[model samples]
Target chain A: MRREGSPFKGLSVVAFKEAADHMASPRMHLVMLLVILTAIGSIYGAIGQIKETVGQDPFLFLRLFTTARDPLPSFMAFLGFLLPLIGIALGFDAVNGEYSRRTMSRILSQPIYRDALLAGKFLGALMVIAICLVTLWLMISGMGILLLGLPPSGEEVLRSFAFLLTSLVYSGVWLAASMLFSTLFRAPATSALAALTLWLVLTLFWGMLAPLAAGAFVPIDPFDPSTAVHQAEIAHALARLSPSTLFGEVTLALLNPATRALGIIFYSQLQGAVMGAPLPFGQSAILIWPQLASLIAGMLVVYTIAYLSFQRQEIRA
Target chain B: MSTPVIEARGLSKRYGPAIAVDALDLTVMKGEVFGLLGPNGAGKTTTILLLLGLTEPTEGSVKVLGRDPLREPLVVKSRVGYLPDAVGFYDHMSAWENLAYTARLAGLEQQDATRRIAAALERVRLPHVAQKRVSTFSRGMRQRLGIADLLVKGCELAILDEPTSGLDPQSTQELLELIGTLAREGMTIVLSSHLLSMVQSVCSRVALFHQGKVGLVGKVSELAGKVLGGSYVIELEAEGCDVPAVARTVEGVSQASRLSNGAVRVDARSDVRGALAAAIVAAGGELKRLSMDRSSLDEVYVRYFEQVDHAA
Candidate 1:
């Protein structure tokens, strides 16, 4: 026996097979249907709003992503809420499902390292997510062209494409979280619930708790206006701890060019800035670079934990 | 002699305080079918996992086909195929797809993988159901498919853990015959099973495992001969006479006893059937039946385990 080849000898095979399985799974279909219907509905609401609102807006196409109807949130908001469900659906059963189905041993027995198995699963799920994101982007842009009859500017295209990339990393964080839970729990349902519970806490409850925690950490004087500013800053920092908050801030910075900064801008900071002036693509990207890096870092951290755990796991079943 | 296909020395595995395989040494020769016989929880499965490098041993080393399994696992795995106890396949995938996935993992190109998958399915006698989902397969078919998976990988050594388990007698016979064919074609196989009769029929050499250790290891016949030490027995059925008393006085008869079935059993250091028959006839007793009793492998197996138990 010789050991000269790459450690990723079987990665493509496993990735292709897993991707096909994810594509065919009913859970994937259900999540995808939920995302697609909500996305279309959101985009439709944006288009109707554009039709009713100011007719001469230059970045009309971009507004299709950020604008919302009176009752419905924007498409970006829906994605920030729903994309994790898709990510969790794809990954919650990745490792344990193999164990439950009794295929983990057989798969590992092949001439592949554990690195390849974990890498293949993550890559396969990410591939599915990429496809879904690209399809939705194209559909929304296509529908915008059909209804609003306005071609997007180059800046609009660049900004919206950046938004899509940021969304990928955002969902990737949840996917890695789900895979981490999958590695921790042997039961697929348990892992799924665990991932979902984390998602719910971060998306819904974390916002409410961050302010209270920040108030406790940085107590403010009731009569001091500057201390109030300090409290708001603390709350903002605490909220940034959640991946959803990071994603939301990134979406705002990318989709709305008129947005200047993510945090509370002081009067001195806004002195040189023009009101209603859209930032350049480069500036907007620079503004959100930290958020992007944090999303990627969160994903890698969780995925690395899952990968190491999987490597150390006993392959009995 | 050719080099051993597998070698393990002082190999041990401990899960917390429970020892699964303890300081075991095993060597398997090339092109021979080796059997690991043990009852449940006797470390047969753990030993297989250790040999495959699926789990790290606590205390020793293993070399499969001249490569250290721990250091060169992919190399060893590429040459070895393992069919775990109660083997499983992707239930939603067709048999061909399942085999093709393995072939791809083994690094075969598409054209080569397709050709080999077809050949393997045909070899396992399951080419007709190549496109059917595995969930719809019978147990025998799934077991045969497991073999096909090994075949497609072109593994030099096939490790089958309880291969005939859960199969009907007819299926077991067929699987045994298939194993025989593979062995004759010069494939080294390591088979583990608790079924002594099945192991005796197929294994050229065997290691009887007890309490996480090999209690006995040798050729079946050699172990029987060594343990029994040339002692032989003769059974006789006689009527109208004191058969047990007369048989006890025969030359070379060490012990004689009347069995519950009205047959007299005589243990002898030499062949005593002819002498016993002659004495019975001379005593005016009717000789109903006379036959030499051969020591079965089952007896050797039972005695070996009993002796080990007593020593423990």
Candidate 2:
């Protein structure tokens, strides 16, 4: 059944058209609208406050803008949570919407392979997210320059870009998650619900639930702060298995480079140091690497499941 | 002779414990319209699915254009256009957008894709409202868009499943005309329908499926020749007479059904009019009416199916 050369000449033509149709869809319009509103709102909100904060102390603006110093919980919260949600929203309907449109079967009937469909969709959604996120990031920085009246240090600029890369990768994880759900469920509503349920598990419940479970099994006292934090860290690792929160955690770490990496509960910075202290970044990364690996592995696992399921599913359905 | 565009040798499909199609052999030659006629649960759709490689065969092999659809589906599929029983379209897209999408997938260059999109819409007579979203299109229009999608592929073999299922008489007529034109253009077509009249009118040959098997297959005329033998049946107003002797005089007459009221019916091999007329005149009986009747497709379909049960 082998063709001597490439066979998708006509199929690519068709897939390309479907991909274009995807771009002009109403869902793209809605995502863009939300992105525009978020950028405008965030920029103006910073503008409204930048003056007073700058006047209060000459160093205040420098610390906030030029360095990661005094990074507020609210900024981290917005960057960590809202951006990933946007990624999810962009992709939640990807496969399921195609299924609903009845274009999926038609496309499959062509010579285009199944993976190309997924790849095209992922690329399209990523481009859309890139546009929105990049716009927002630039808008915020522009507002900072105008109001704070301070230039970002080279270090700050480098870190911001690093943070942006981290944010993009983090968003991709959610997009994959959303698409995985899309393939798992046939109905768009069900796919949306499944994605949100994952979000809630990662964002709200996983953090609290893991610690409680570990604590229950260990049955340690709160006065033992180290023990409790250990449990929380373990719980966080377990929770990070949910790609959404793992991405959020990774992005937060990138935004503020001072924070310790996530993974194992380090007894102290010492690997049998003369005296045990908090773990160093090397030890922390070593500990966190496993969790990171696990999170990446989990994404692949779900994606693989979706791929196999789709390959196996009959066109009759 | 045209090459066989679709060839299947003992094709079969089983959905777990249920056998959807069983040991079915078929071949559809190029540039001819063939039909698979059956009722709703009689496996017309299953046979089509097997041909498209949408479902794997449980027992036998299928080759379209000399390629196994299961193994080289992309190559075969690229050359084959399929319109499922219910052609589904994205409701949000206009007919033009939908056609454009399919055309691109069919591997037409941007320029050619646009050209074919227009031509297909025109062929279906849907060019005027090309930009109208399928959501607002009536059932007939949606079906038209569906046909346009299949045609845009520019494939050699076209498969239409339940093409006229819900169509009104006018739309059905138009669709039939379009099909006639495609056939004239030498496009190999596989038409599945439950409408015997439609099949009888357009199909050169047919494969009748029943309970997951091809119960019968032959040229429509040949099948008609074998199943519908020479016979004449007429209701008559007649007084008492020698009905058997009148029947015997007709050459090759096999049997006759005589009503108690003296109306005579006869089954014969050749034209029985002269012998019957001579017998009638000699016997002093009046021939009220005479007409000929042959075995119909409906009866052949019934007889073949009943034979399946008897053999089982």
lDDT per residue for candidate 1 within B93-188, as digits (tens), equals 999999988888889989999999999888889999999999999888899999999988999999999999999999899899999999999899
lDDT of 2 at B82: 83
Going through the candidates in order, what fraction of the true interface contacts does each contain? 0.70, 0.52
Measured on C-alpha atoms, candidate 1 has an lDDT of 0.90
RMSD of each: 2.8, 5.6
* C-alpha local distance difference test of each model: 0.90, 0.69
For candidate 2, what is the lDDT?
Answer: 0.69
Which parts of model 2 are misplaced by more than 4 Å?
Answer: A1-23, A35-50, A54-76, A83-88, A150-153, A221-233, A260-298, B225-295
Residue A222 in candidate 2, Cα distance off native in Å: 9.6
Local accuracy of candidate 1 as per-residue lDDT tens digits, A122-194: 9999999999999999999999999989889999999999999998998899999999999999999999999
Candidates' DockQ values?
0.55, 0.41
